[model samples]
Target chain A: MTSEIIIQAIVTGLMMGLIYALIAAGLSLIFGLMEIVNFAHGEHLMLSMFSSFWLWSLFGLDPLFSIPITILLLAFCGIITHYFLIRYILKAKMLIQICATFGLSIFIRSIAQLLWTPDFRNVDKPLLEGRIEIGSVFIGQPQLYASLVCLVAFFGLYWFVTKTETGLALQATAQDRHAAEILGIPSNKMFAIGWAIGLGCVGVAGGMMANYFFIFTDVGINFALFAFVAVALGGFGSIIGCLYAGIIIGLVESLGGLLIDPSFKLLYVFAIYLLVVIYKPQGLFGRY
Target chain B: MDSRLEFAKSEPIWNTNNRVFSIIAGLIILLFALPLFGMNSFYLHLFIMIFMHAVMAQSWNVIAGFSGQISLGHGAFFGIGAYATSFFYMEYGITPWISIFFGMFVSAIFAVLIGIPMLRLSGHYFAIATLLIGISFQVVFQRWDLVGAASGLWVTMTPEDSWFALQFHSSKVPYYYVFLVFFLITFFLVWLLSRSKLGYRLRAVRDDPQAALSLCINVSNYKIIAYVISAMIMAPMGSLFAQYILIIDPDRVFNIEISIIVLLITVLGGIGNVWGPIIGASILVPISEYSRIYLGGTGGAVDLIFYGLILMIICIFRPNGLISFIPKDILERKKQR
Candidate 1:
């Protein structure tokens, strides 16, 4: 491959990675705090994407304009899901927790199929519709804006978790719920907050993705699998790790597709994941 | 006094075993007699599905339930079985009866390959790795032209019924009996395994791998054994299903939904128990089938919605599973008395 082509692939991979990071950040946070791997994390992203798609299709509202609404709506969804489903199973066995989330994923996907007719929907006439050329490389405007927004959101999340008192409490809760409770942190509330923030990141990804990607009930699953990989690769529960890991996955996917066959791209991604898991089970950036 | 106490303990165990054996024997005889009464083909088909899934779930139970290794990618083994059997039949015109064994062998080998490295990871990591492996198989199979790629492969069925071919013409009866026998054998094998030393080792590893390791138990070896056994058991179902359906597709057999459904059925019934998969399959298959027939095409996923709700509820209320519920309650009542 030419240097220019390689550079383009890298750029594209980086952009895709940002979106993956955004999606995985929530999953990482939730796992860190609750030790529950929400198998339905991708379904929530699917829900958000549909929300964005519906808003666009129904009211002629641009997905760019629907970002805030989608985040708020998904945050509400996260809260409700936690309150109704997750809360009861908080102290359940690992198998039970996995099943509950998995069932919820199936439930959400099936419901979406029922309600939305399983037809693939995409936002027509998105605001960012063109590509921008820089020297020898060209980039889609949607991709650029999506990555920029993701970068902002990721950094914003980092600021919230590390700098603020609420963030410190959230971390403390994740570190030791009992100790945090003793120290005046409402661990339950922190869990709720974690859910909201985690889902809120997926919401952001969904809204941005709604501009370029096809929307369907099962669409989130395709991306969600990658998010899981990113979370695992970055070492679970580290936001910065997810960001870098997502980028690495995206780059690998794009470059692997370019270098090898596109169909074999996932093979390369999985290869990296297995190597990391075998050698570094804690992930590239995980403290554990 | 010690001998008398041992005899007292052994007596109840023997009695309970005899009672369970008799009940199982009675049920088997009833199952064998059902077709003679001229049951409808639809119910027979449902029974076949229940049996097939029960076998598959039991296979899952060997690893996830007994060995405490949660594999989210068992569909890969199922797919391997289906594909291997169908390929042999299609390319070489091998009968599915013999080809099913080939499928089982292939799946067992695949399980070993996967289990060796993956068994090292604990908890959710193993689950995720298996899930990825399942998806990767799907992707590869979908793209590989040798296996019919995305469109899928169809087995040609002769008009003449051939027992050797494992094909029956115009009747679900033979298929039902074949599946019933297979289900019984699988269940019996699992029961025997559970009662054996290996089963105890598996249970010990599951309960506490550290303790098991300290006691000199080869935890990895036992886990791999469970995984291989589970995969081998699951493969034949896929082969039978392919022959029964007369078609095999990567997406159909290799789908993650299949894996999830197997897990749900096993867990829903009572993981690790011989009866768990049977009970779970009996409840789930009929409900899903009925929902599909009644509530399908209504632009709403009523069946899946209900299915999801039931799964959530079951996980919450009876996490040990539906099969364990009545017995536990009965035992409690007896204790109170």
Candidate 2:
């Protein structure tokens, strides 16, 4: 492969990795706040893409402009999921907890299929529809914009969690729920807010992807798998770890696809995940 | 307080008392005699599906229920069983009976190879790792030309019922009886497991690995045992499914949906219980069949949506499963420790 093609692959991988990081960030945030793995997380991304697609198809608003709306819609969904489903399983057994979210995932995906047939849909002509040449390498404008937005969002979330009081309170609750409660922090509300923010990140990433990637009910499964890998690689509760891990996964996926078989790209990623999990069960940045 | 303690110690989940045993025995007898009624193909097919799913759920229960290691990639073992049996029969002209053993052996070996590294991680980590592994198997098998690739393998047709060939083109009744035998075998094995010391140790490992370790239990070894047994049990059923359906494909055999469906059945019936798979399959299979019959096609998702709702509701309200609703008095009887 030519150096230019390799560079192009790297750029593409980096952009895709940013989106993966943002999605993983949401998952990591929720895990940080509470030790629940949302098996339905991929469905949340599916919902976001659908949300953006519908907005564009019905109102003729570009995905770029529909970002805030998708974010709000997904955030609302997160809160609803939290209040209605998550709260009940908070103290359930591990198997039950896993099943609840898993059930929600199937439920959401089926509903999506019911409402919108499984045919792949895409934004016909979004505002950002082309590629930009940077010297000898080229990048899709949609991918570039999506990656930029995701990068900004990742930093923004990092800031909110670290510098803000509410974020600290959320962290406190995650660290020790009873202690945080004693300190007058409503851990319940923090959990709901955590879900909202967590899914909001998915919303942004999904909406951005709707510009280029196909919008479909099952689209989230693959992306969600990547996010899970990123979260596991980066460490479950570390935001920055997701960023680095996401990039690494992206590069590996693209380069592996370029160098080897594109079909086995997922296999390579899974291999890395298995290696990390076997050697460092705690993850590269995991506290537990 | 002493009586309550005794009651608590009683393993009521099995309900091994004479009355319950007689009732269960009668039910099995009835099932065995079902083919005598000359039921139509549809009912027979449903029964066959129920039996097959029950066996699958029971196998899963060996691991997730007893050992508390929820593997989301069980389809890999199932696919191995399917592929191995079908490949041997299709290519080498071997009987499925012999190939079935090959499938089980391969699955057991794969389980150990997978379980050693994966069983170290707990909870979501292990679950997702297995899930990814399952997906990768599908990807690999799809591209593998040796196994017929994406087009899958189709078993040769037979004009008449042939036990040797493990095919019944004339009627579904033979397949029903075949699957019933497998189900009963799996059921008996699980029943035996519940009474075994290995079962207790597995339960110990599941309930408290740290405590199990302190008690000198080989936690990882027990888990691997449970996992291997689970995989072994699952493989034969895959072989049977391939024989019965006369087709084996990567998508059908290796799909993650198979794993999830197995989970739902075991969870719905009752996890960690001998009869959980039976009860779960009895309820779930019918719902799936009827829904497919009536609410299929453009409304295809109705059943799945219903299943999803049922799963969530069960997880939220009846984490112990529908078996919990059988009345504690029936499931539990006063017994001396």
Best model per DockQ: 2
Worst 10 residues of 2 chain B by lDDT: B1-10
Chain A, model 2: TM: 0.99
lDDT, candidate 2, residue B173?
A: 86
Question: After aligning candidate 1 to the native by TM-score, how far in Å is the CA of B109 from where it should be?
Answer: 1.5
Per-candidate clash tally: 1, 0
- Give the per-residue lDDT digits (tens) of candidate 1, residues B18-71: 455677679999999999999999999999999999999999999999998888
User: Which structure among the candidates has the greatest TM-score?
Assistant: 2
The TM-score values for the models, in the order shown, are: 0.95, 0.97
Estimate, for each residue in A1-288, the C-alpha lDDT of model 1 and write its tens digit: 689999999999999999999889989999989989989988999999999988988888899999999999999999998888888899987878888998888888888887788888888889899999999999999999999999999999999999999999999999999999999998889989999999999999999999999887788876888889999999988889999999999999999999899888878989998889888888999867
Q: How accurate locally, in lDDT, is each candidate?
A: 0.87, 0.91
**Which run of 10 residues does model 1 chain A get worst, by summed lDDT?**
A216-225
